[model samples]
Target: MINNLFSAVSAAAAQEHFDELLRRPGLRIERIVSQGQASPTGFWYDQPQGEWVVLLSGSAGLRLAHEPSERVLSPGDFVEIPAHCRHRVEWTDTSAPTVWLAVHFDAV
Candidate 1:
């Protein structure tokens, strides 16, 4: 049963924040669990997957590597993490569920 459609959360696109939404074969979706007030500190993964994160609820900080840019995301803001791109979090709300959606992929 799908009621309260108005209460359902949705984001059209990651305007100005995401690099590019690449959709193709061999791509996979990964689970990102950032419970409480914790985040990865400017790290890079040894893989070919780009992460596109959308802030489902609460607030969080997304810092880009080699770039002097820090984005504080609310409930609807989204971001695209490039493949092997190093990054870190500047801050996150301590009293809220910081839910996020991450999509990963490999470049051909």
Candidate 2:
């Protein structure tokens, strides 16, 4: 089967959308769409699995717990977050949908 990642997105969505694309032992892939969504104040994500994510469209602000400043991510930008690394989404573009391709995997 063939599918397009940029299809079926809701531009007027009030909250971020997460779609699971594939899953297998020790690995998972997802398509995330965000529009003006951000992590709650003082909140952070600490996951057991590491994540490698790429910005496909629009832009976003990503902050790591150990970093003093947020990293601005543009289209084609990518990041690898180790397991147990605390991170948060500072913000996403409000004028357009920010598409992200995220892969979560167990550390070897």
Candidate 3:
């Protein structure tokens, strides 16, 4: 089946939307749509899998534990986060939905 990444977007959203595009052993792909969402204060993500993610549209702020400042991501911006790297989503565009493509994979 053919699919479009920008499809299935809702103009009125109260929370972030997560769509799983593909999944297999040790790997997962997802499309995330965010509107004015951020990780709760004092909370962080520590995962056992590495993640490669890209900002497909809108904008966002990402903070990593080893980084001194948050990294601002615009459309097309991408990053590779290693396993066990504590990270958080600091901010996302509120006026428009922020789209993201993320690939998570366990170390080989």
What candidate 1 gets wrong by more than 4 Å, as runs, is 1-25, 31-35, 40-47
TM-score of 1: 0.62
Candidate 2 pairs with clashing backbones: none
Model 3 lDDT per residue over 36-78, tens place:
9999999999999999999999899999999999999999999
Q: For every candidate structure, what is the RMSD over all alpha carbons to the true structure, in angstroms?
A: 8.4, 0.6, 0.8
For candidate 2, the TM-score is 0.98
Best-performing candidate as measured by TM-score: 2
lDDT by residue (1-108, candidate 1, tens digit) is 654312423233222122222455866543343434444454534446776777767688777776788788898898878877877777665554455666776654
TM-score, ranked from best to worst: 2, 3, 1
TM-score versus the correct structure, for each prediction: 0.62, 0.98, 0.97
Residue 74's C-alpha lDDT in candidate 1? 90
> Across residues 1-108, which tens digit of lDDT does each residue of candidate 2 receive?
899999998785898999999999999999999999999999999999999999999899999999999999999999999999999999999999999999999987
Best by lDDT: 2
- Residue 30, candidate 1: how far off, in angstroms? 3.9
Q: Evaluate model 1: give its lDDT.
A: 0.59
